[model samples]
Target: MRRFLDKLYLVSGALAAIFTVGVLVAVTMSIVTRQLGVHIGGLNAYAGYSMAAAGFLALAHTFKSGEHIRVTLILSSLPAKGRMRLDLCALVIACIIAGNLCWFSFKLVLDSYAYNDISTSDDATPLWIPQISMAVGTLIFFIAILDETIRRYKGIPETIQSEEAHYE
Candidate 1:
C-alpha cells in the first residue's frame, strides 16, 4: 500500500509537470502565432486550463514532498508528544477540508457534464474535460491527507520528518 501510494503521488507530480509544460507550450504558441500575424482562437484558454490542471494536480505531491509552506517555528518548538498531537489535529482538519474540496470538485464536474456545459472561450471546450483533472487531483490529495492522518494516529513518524531533519 505504501509503494502504491508513493507511486500515485509520483505519477500525479509527473502529470503536473506535463501540464506545466503544456501551459508553456500554449503560451509560446500564442505569442509566436501573434508575432506571425495569425490569431489563434483558444490559446489563452488552453493556457488557463493547463495552469489550473498543473496547480490542482501538484497538490498531493507537493504535500507529500513537504514543499507546502508550514509554520515550522511553532511545530519545532513543541516537545515530541505535543508536536504529534498538534500535527494530528492539523492533519485531521486538513483531511476534512481536502475531503470537502474533493467532493465538491467531483460534484461540479458531474453538474457540468449533465448540463453539457462548454467553455466561454472560442474553443468551446467541454467544461467537464478540464474539470476531471481538478476532481482527480483533489481526490488524490484527500487520499494523501487521510493516509498521513492514519499514519500519525498509529504513531508513525511524520512524512515530513526527513525534510525537517535538514534544518536541524
Candidate 2:
C-alpha cells in the first residue's frame, strides 16, 4: 500500500511536470506562430489550462514530500503526547476542509458537464475537461491528508522533515 501510494504521488508529480512543460510549449508555440504571421486562436486559454493542471496535480505529491508550508513553531514547543494530539486535531480539520473542497470541485465539474459549458474563447473547449484535474487533485490531496491522520493515530510519524536533522 505504501509503495502504491508513493507511486501514485510520483506519477501525479510527473503529470504535473508534463503539464508545466505543456504550458511552456503552448506559450512558445504561440509566440513562434505569431512571429510567423499566423493567428492561433486560444493559445492563451490552452496555456492557462495547462498551468491549472500543473498546479492542481502537484498538490498531493508536494504535501507528502514535506514541501508544503506548515506552522511548526507551536508544534515544536509541545511535549510528545501533546504534539500528537495537536497534530491529530490539525489533520482532522485539514481532512474536513479538503474533503469539502474535493466534493465541491467534483460538483463543479458535474455542473459544467450538465450545462454543456464551453470556454468563451475561440477554442470552445469544454470546461469540465479542465475541471477534472482540479477534482482529481483535490481528491488525492484529501486521501494524502487522511493517510497522514491514520499514521498519526497509529503513532507513526506524519511527514519526514529534513529540517529536524538539519537543526540538530
Candidate 1 has its poorest 10 consecutive residues by lDDT at 158-167
Error of 1 at 140 (Å): 0.4
Please give, for residues 1-168, the per-residue lDDT of candidate 2 as tens digits: 988988888899999999999999999999999999999999999999999999989999998998888878898999989988998999999999999999999999999999999999989999999999999989888988899899989888866774576479
Q: After superposition, how far is residue 67 of candidate 2 from its true place, in Å?
A: 0.3
Off by over 4 Å in 1: 162-164
- Expressed as tens digits, the lDDT of each residue in 61-152 for candidate 1 is 99999888888788888999999999999999999999999999999999999999999999999999999999999999999999999999
Instruction: Kindly give the number of clashing pairs for every candidate.
Output: 0, 0
Error of 1 at 81 (Å): 1.0
Alpha carbon lDDT of residue 161, candidate 2? 74
